[model samples]
Target chain A: MYTSLFYKEWIKTRRPLLLLSAVFAATVAYILLNVAKLYQANPVALWEFIVQNNAAQAGYLKYLTLGAGIALALVQLAPEMQNKRLKLTLHLPLNESKIVGSILWFGIVALTGLYLASGAILLAGLTVYFPAEIVSANLLAMLPWMLGGLAAYLFAAWICLEPVWRQRVLYTIPALGCTSLFYLDALPGAYLPFVPWLASLTVAGFAFPFYSAIRFKQGVQ
Target chain B: MNAIIQCENITHYYGNRLIYENLNFEVMPGKILGLLGKNGTGKTTIINILTGFLKPRAGVCRIFGEAMERLTPAAKSRIGLLLEGHIQHTYFNIEQIEKFYSRFFPKWKREAYYELLKRLQVTSTQKISAMSCGQRSQVALGLLFAQDPDLLILDDFSMGLDPGYRRLFVEYLREYITAENKTVFLTSHIIQDMEQLIDDCIIMDYGRILLHEPAAHILNHFRRFRFTSDADEIAPADGTLWHTEKVGNNWETYSFASAADVQRTLADGGAAVSGLAEERLSLEDAFIGLTGKY
Candidate 1:
């Protein structure tokens, strides 16, 4: 049942998601090429990239990996809510947590895939143009950040979609706060887990709201 | 007959606003219960709560004697529901929906699904998005029949269907009920269409159940009485009160009980009476009488 929900969500979202992915890939490719050119033409840009990204690998991972997670999260749920299709799913004599959680799971998987593709392109650019500071450990360390971002994204979705006005506005404010954290890129690991505004704004994202089966029970008869 | 569904004081509230309160009702085995309600009534809300789609604020409900919240596999297996609107993943063809649902419901009968597909005259390959509104509505009914449930709950039965399909569906449903002794609960705007099929009806308004009785009883006991009353309104002590309207110095009152009590009262008041005739109660009249608003 869980897998079917995921598969259904995938079938519904795969087209636009893949299309957006292709667009994201093109944009990332452009950014990577531009970064390489800046490094060769004016060494100052090289110092700037190092200063910005090398400070904390989590910050870079939180923004890029979480951004990817945000896209996937939106791809999974936004249309369902907009079209009121979630009612169809919830009406069935099934567990809402798993139904909603399965969509979240698909989003996490999709984001992980995006991270793999984007990371490859970024890594290749670093290897050819500037290999001085790009380490494999630094790359490996971004996994927690990616997972954390995914959790935060799902958490925001849960709170925002309470099917009531107060909860709707309630879910909206926290989401705004988290997205702001992602944009600022200065959020530390200690604060990331609590950032309900987004999926990747925290340390492990699990702390934000990890599909607490408790929530669905209260709502359905 | 055993009650397949029972609700005691089932009250539902959205935030602080009470949609309905103190709702008590039941559907007995081998009986088709018709839910009659005007627009904005809580008919759909009750269905949603029973199907476990929406929660009630305070109430104890049992399906097959098991609490709804528990919703065991055995209990859930026995219940089937079709919400007010016909919903489908428009991009998916009817066959795809059939295939997907077949996997979900453990007791789903493949042969019955095909049989219903033929009976409903729906092509398996027709995508829901591509189908006309009426065809999609038929497809929704097709899915419900495929489940072969013991307790079936439907909301707005004839909302978007043509008269021809409506008659065919009712005929098919009648046979299905007789053959299987299944319990059916339906809410619809057009009570006339279901007048022959439903065994009993519960009239609802503003989330309140105003009346519950056998369809035959409603037909036999209730009537419309037109009389002239100089007073603004006359409240009769006895009989089922339906609705009242003032025309000039006269009043036309529709009552579920025999009009003898109300007619005698108006005559006792010494008001000039004419058109003192008994009118047959249409479903629309029964609805208006029960809800006051058309």
Candidate 2:
């Protein structure tokens, strides 16, 4: 049953997922090519500049992950809400909670795979021109942004699953507030100490969609 | 035999406005019951509550002897639902949707679905979103038939269909239900189409049910009586006649009473009756007569 549910989710999301993947790849390639050009011009100066200014050199990738997360959730979930189509899904011959959980799990798993591949490419690309310390630092700096992206996906699910427009607007305030914490500082290692808290927030975001699903089942308007 | 669908004293409100109160109805096995009502009379509301999408304010609905709000998966498997507008996952192609739904149902009838789809000029790879309203309705009906549920709840089945599609739907549905002895509960604004399909009906007025009887009974018993009177005014007692309108010397009213009884009642009300006639009504006329064509 879960596999079938995932299959439906995959059908709805595969197009947007592919589009986001292309965008991610182009963004990563653009960031890496710029880094290569700078290294070719003067490798010592680039390293000295990075060490002194604590620049992650991947600032352009900041909102790219977050946007991917939000886009994936919309493609995966918006169809279910259209024309109150979720009623058809909820009416399926399965436990409603299990059905909703499977849908969310599919989106989360898909997003995780995309993020890992994109992050890995960025890490490996930088390793060729820089030492291990700078590569590790760059990876750490982007970690919170990726976590923020996951949180945004879950939060977007909550908003889209909401049955009422007014309540959805109300939910966005808190969702935006919580996700903002992931971008407080973009410097390398700055978010390392707050990683646990951000991860906790992402975990907590998963529960919000269930609350919305409950309201949807209750026919709140 | 237990009722396939039952509702006890369902009361509901939208904010301060009351949609209905103490509303009650039941659908017995092998019976196709149609809920007929004007706009905002809680026809779809009842469907929503029965399917557990909307929680009523003051009552419980049970399907197959289980509370609607907590229907087990086993119970859910025995029911099929068609939402308003025949809504489905428009993103999926014809074949993909079948593949998606076939996994969950133990009794999924793949041939039943394809048999209906064969009537349409659509390919297996065609997306449902690209279909017209009529075509979408066919797909929805095909899916419901494929589910092979014991009870089917359809909301506004005839909403967007042309005459040809409507006839096709009613004929197909009636044939299927008769062959399988399936119970059906549905609503439609098109009373003529419903007349050819429904075995029984629940006609609803605002906040209450006006009548619940077999379609044959309403067609055979309830009628319109027109008479010419010489008196200046003719007014029968309130309960004896409905929507009485007097134009010039002709008077028209509707009731379940016989022509003799109507004449007697009008004579007692001090009107001199001359030519009196009772006219048989179609289901649409009967509906309008009972509910006062407002």
Give lDDT: candidate 2, residue A6.
91
Residue A154 of model 2, lDDT score: 97
Error of 2 at B263 (Å): 1.0
In the range A23-75, model 1's lDDT, one tens digit per residue, is 65776677666666777788796758656765232233446555665556666
Q: Specify the CAPRI tier of model 1.
A: acceptable
Per-residue lDDT over B1-294 for candidate 2, one digit per residue giving the tens place of the 0 to 100 score? 889999999999988889888988889999999999999998999999999999988999999999999999999989999999999999999999999988878899999999999999999999999999999999999998899999999999999899999999999999999999999999999999899888999999999999999999999999999888767666666587777777666878899999999888888887778788999999999998889878
Model 1 lDDT tens row, B122-218: 5778778787666777677777778788988877877777888777667777788778888998888777777867889898878688888988887
Ten-residue region with minimum lDDT total, candidate 1 chain A: A208-217
Q: What is the TM-score of chain B alone in each candidate?
A: 0.89, 0.97
Off by over 4 Å in 2: A48-53, B230-235, B247-249
Worst 10 residues of 2 chain B by lDDT: B229-238
Best by lDDT: 2
Model 2: per-residue Cα lDDT over A37-121, one tens digit each: 8799998878776876586866767888789888888998899999999999999989999989999899889888888998899
- Candidate 1: stretches off by over 4 Å: A31-64, A82-84, A128-132, A137-148, A179-221, B13-18, B111-127, B162-175, B227-233, B247-251, B256-265, B268-275
